[model samples]
Target chain A: MTATDRQATGATWLRRNRQVVAPVLFLLPGLLFFLVYVLLPVAQSVQISFFRWDGLGEPDYVGLANYRELAGDRAFEVSVINNVKWLLLYLLAIPGGLFIALFLNQTVTGIRLYKSLFFFPFVISQVVVGLVFTWFYDPTFGLLNAILGAVGLGPVNVLGDPALATYGIIVAGLWPQVAYCMILYLTGLNAVDPEQVEAARLDGAKGWRMLWYVILPQLRPATFIAFVVTIIGALRSFDLISVMTNGGPFGSTRVLSFYMFEKALGEYGFRMGYGAAIAVVLFLIMLVFIAYFLWSMWRQERGA
Target chain B: MKTAWTTTAALALLAALPATAQDESLSGTLTIFSDMSNPAPRAVMEDMAARFDEMHPDLEVELTIIEREAYKTQIRNFLTANPPDVANWYAANRMRPYIEAGLFEDVSDLWAEPEIAENLASTKSALTVDDKQWGVPYTYYQWGVFYRADIYEEHGLEEPADWEGLKSNCQTLLDAGTKCFAIGTKFLWTAGGWFDYINMRTNGYDFHMQLTNGQVPWTDERVRTTFANWRELIDMGAFIDNHQSYSWQEALPFMVNGDAAAYLMGNFAVAPMREAGLTDDQLGFYQFPLIDPDLPMAEDAPTDTFHIPSGAENKEAARAFLRFVVSPENQTLINGGDALGQLPVNAASEVDEDKFLEEGFEMLSANAPGGIAQFFDRDAPAEMASVAMEGFQEFMVFPDNLDDILGRLEQARQRIY
Candidate 1:
């Protein structure tokens, strides 16, 4: 407010250019926090990957020894295969969510309640979801086995059987994931341009055709978000697997993230270097996808 | 000099302080990190800590109890960064890495000075690494086959003495529509218990130790014989149906309901079985049946310890706490409950009136002349133990894969050791 105070402050250009200066000042704290927490840890994890550390002492430089060990590990193989299965099967959520969203999109009585009810699993903690699904899949006294028994079929130990455990967990994970995607699609549908739809309808775009061309194109943002989250959910599948199976019934249900955690922190003795190597592998996997996504987005922006 | 004058002034100020404050009676805030998070054990620990506080009224103890799984990971980090004065840990190889890294302090003086070492000689060997004790092993429990006494009585099954006795008992139990054993390999460690017992009984204590310590290869003949005995149990349908589907805790229903005859587990299991409505007379403790008959028996006894972290600020207070913990009066609190029980390592500790505890004591002394094991996981390196536990679980589910499992174990053993 005073000329003297204004004179004492440096950078007259910044004072004049208030718009740029204010935005940079506002962004500084968030950017600093992001760099410290997320970016720093990621870089540190990458650095740790080269050394054979036990999480407690001086890390020994092992170069590619850990990655080499991972190459031959059966547990690693099983987990990688399981992760692939999770990725492929997890995509079903996008379609499943859209279907449920469209079904409940109508103005029926108690529609809001129905929508909320369908989204219930997503609202519940993952730990609770895992426990519920575990009891549901219990061989002796579970709902699934009870149903199987009712149908004159033998009781199948879904979580116990190595061949079936991963599938059982993925199905449990999908329950809430579908709900997430459904909510995204519902919100996207609410934002759909009514006039564009009217024009499409007048042009005889109806049913599957209308949804495929007119409606889905409008829900692109939602679909992109759903895909991103579903992929993340698949890759970092830890809590559900931890609660339901604990990578057990002979370590069949472990994913890359859970395996990394086990090697790094679990009582398998601290193998921090090996765990870091696994994390680096997983990061590289996600990086490839992210880089492609960013490239594609950049292309889209340029075209637009 | 100005520095000398400042030093003189500071010294004069210190000299003017109260004499009582400088007394070595340990009257400061003592921080303790404990992993006794289970309701019963945690209660026993709290009771012991409260007793310590009462005994030394001036010393205020701040006890922080961490959950078991999280504690294992956090303890290492805490020991490095900000350490509690006293911390609970496991003995043997579990403490070896910490001791070697100098994370845990060598409290050999406490063992020597107070003559507490003589009282707990049985546990001294376990807490000792490099001929020096790093911890005070306060508690451990016996592991064996817990059977339903009534079921055994009805079946005319005398306590199984050898492979034949065990086989006949299993046959009779199966004939009577009762499963021979209730094993839950879902957690995988339960199978390790079975492997330890059979390996020790078949090859004797020395061979079992050598094998677990990775001196003997998994492809060795003694291991094959051990697995052969294990295979016999598998072939006879010894374990309850779908044993793989349940955790050790979940498998208790079979024993409690009399659907299964016995469970090979630690003494901690008695608590759950009692909670599940089994009476004292109904529950019976017995060492696992002998396999070689010539070889001596060894029981699985996992010891829990308390140690002083090297970075402790209150070394004196931590030692004082350990002194209290090692007392026979405090050890008895671990056995106060009707069901939940852990045997105190202190030889002078009052014996429990509980029949199962008495039986455990008697069995441990009489049968385990060859020596006692610290269970499979505790006995072997954690890395190797994990692999072995997994392999054993797999073998339990698929008995025909013994050779493959053994080969895989050998590969892992070679990689680790």
Candidate 2:
């Protein structure tokens, strides 16, 4: 057959099938992978939450008993309280990042190096960060204790005291998280229109007022991203706690993620069902915030 | 017909390849998941595997040494999916869950072998569950107070034999501005050592076993008494301040530097203690002092064992490896004759001639009305042990929190059981 005839047939076939077939074909691989890996495990976890499985033997069905058990578990209560503290304290990173961003916003000599230096913590892996801070907080000879002793104030066992362990880990997490927010704001600042800023300055907008009304309104996208990531980061704060204290000093440092790990895979011996229930609770928590975040983003997008 | 005859003879030899008993020519890949990832011990383990490989020319052994912490979690998953031929684990309660899950082979027949059985006879009770042997313990070490002899002498503190003597020494040491005990409970298991000693001393070995087995409740008056006795040292400020900030190894500096006088730890800690510049002449070993004159004395001796996974493809090779690991030559090499202070489980082995081992062995075997008990975590279910260890750590940090901690542990005990 002639080349024109083959081309015509191909174009006709594409024109005939582009509407329904193409979209399904495009969605096949990703949809299949998500269903298998993400959705299926979640469903299985929810199912297992009702039983008493040890991850090895047959799961004995004990309907809502694990949840009932959670209600009375002191460790679970401690873990939830610590998670709330983590979420609240982790919000500091958003403002912390903004302050650093504002301070470093000027175009000065060697500012690129300074910006990268400020961004160093985010570049570090959480495990390394945890180790560094763990050494720093060591009560006997740690830098923090050494300084405190010099000042005649503390020698406080920051990572050891039940009252202070979670805060110590959250501060470690914030080191990286603050750096993350700073980078987000830096990029958003770059996108800020210079004309609008100059116009706001002409209208007598200065320092705090300039930041709040003029710059922050324009930096809405960045703030939104920072808020979303900070909240998610707080909930997903496991590695720092794991490396710093292993949810220790009487399990006071345990967030939901770390507590679930201790239950499911730690030397605590398999309580897979209970771990799943913990995971379900954490998921519901994230789901609520996720809905709120999406709603806000949707409102912004509609206006934009 | 003549070719068929020769082929049938060849097939018959192939059928007889894997003999039930000890076969000199067992040929297959033997996979081992070992948790001995330390530099010195891992080198010794690798050498043993190489020598075993050379002895059985056709048998190929694959030794995979995993980081100790990661190995604990990985073993649960790997034992069921694509299991290895051999795996190393702690002997008693640590091995129970897997044994009950049918993940490990019984290994009773290996115990029946006269040579292996004779050397490992003392450990027979440790490796057995339900009247059947489950594993062969290759090495174990003693846990006791390793103290600074020079400091003890300078301060005129005698090695304590009873509660009163220990308290006196602690008081003298405190007056001298030196802490009595150096401990770090950041990882939680270090606290388990204290609990084991307390529980064993307060309520004899049988009671300890019963308590660990869930036959006794945390609310039992006996359990409360153990806590009360431990709280004495805590109230007296005998421990390093802010001990929760250091790991067990990190806390050794206090004892080694003479700021603290004693350490309740395993014999394995000797290497690090020595590495910290403490000489053998400066350091001394003693059993944890007697708490109750009436109760029998029992020490914490955690035995390390090797077991064949039930799903192992080459059982004969796995048994051969176990036999080789427990041999006198391998034990001596791994324990390092008069070097690292580890004790091999093989009774007939010639090593463990060091001062600490000799002293520890005497303390564990000679004066005890009761036999040895595994450490608290090793003796108890892993789940209960975690809660109990956490409670002990909390109690150490806040002595006033004892009742609250015990109440919480009781809640966990009921729920976990």
**Segments in model 2 whose C-alpha atoms lie over 4 Å from true places:** A1-13, A16-28, B1-23, B338-341
Q: What's the number of clashes in each of the models?
A: 0, 0
Predictions in order: lDDT:
0.86, 0.87
lDDT of 1 by residue, B166-262 (tens): 8998999999999999988878888999988888888888988888888999999879988998989899898987777788888888888899999
Q: Please, what are the lDDT tens digits per residue for candidate 2 over residues B21-132? A: 3335667799988998878768767887887776665678899999987898889889999899999898888888888899999999988999887887777888989999
Which docking category, incorrect, acceptable, medium or high, applies to candidate 1?
A: medium
| Residue-by-residue lDDT tens digits, candidate 2, A1-304 | 9999999999999989889779999999999999999899999989999988888878899999999989978889988999899999999999999999999999899999999999999998999999999989887678998898888995688988888888888899999999999999999999999999999999999999999988999898899999999999999999998889988888888989999988988777589999999999999999999999989888978998
In model 1 chain B, where is the ten-residue run with the lowest total lDDT?
Answer: B15-24
- Fnat score for model 1: 0.79
Give lDDT tens digits, candidate 1, residues A127-220: 9999999999988789998999999999898998989999999999999999999999999999999999999999988999999999999999
Q: Alpha carbon lDDT of residue B348, candidate 2?
A: 74
* Model 1 spans > 4 angstroms off: A1-11, A199-205, B1-24, B338-340
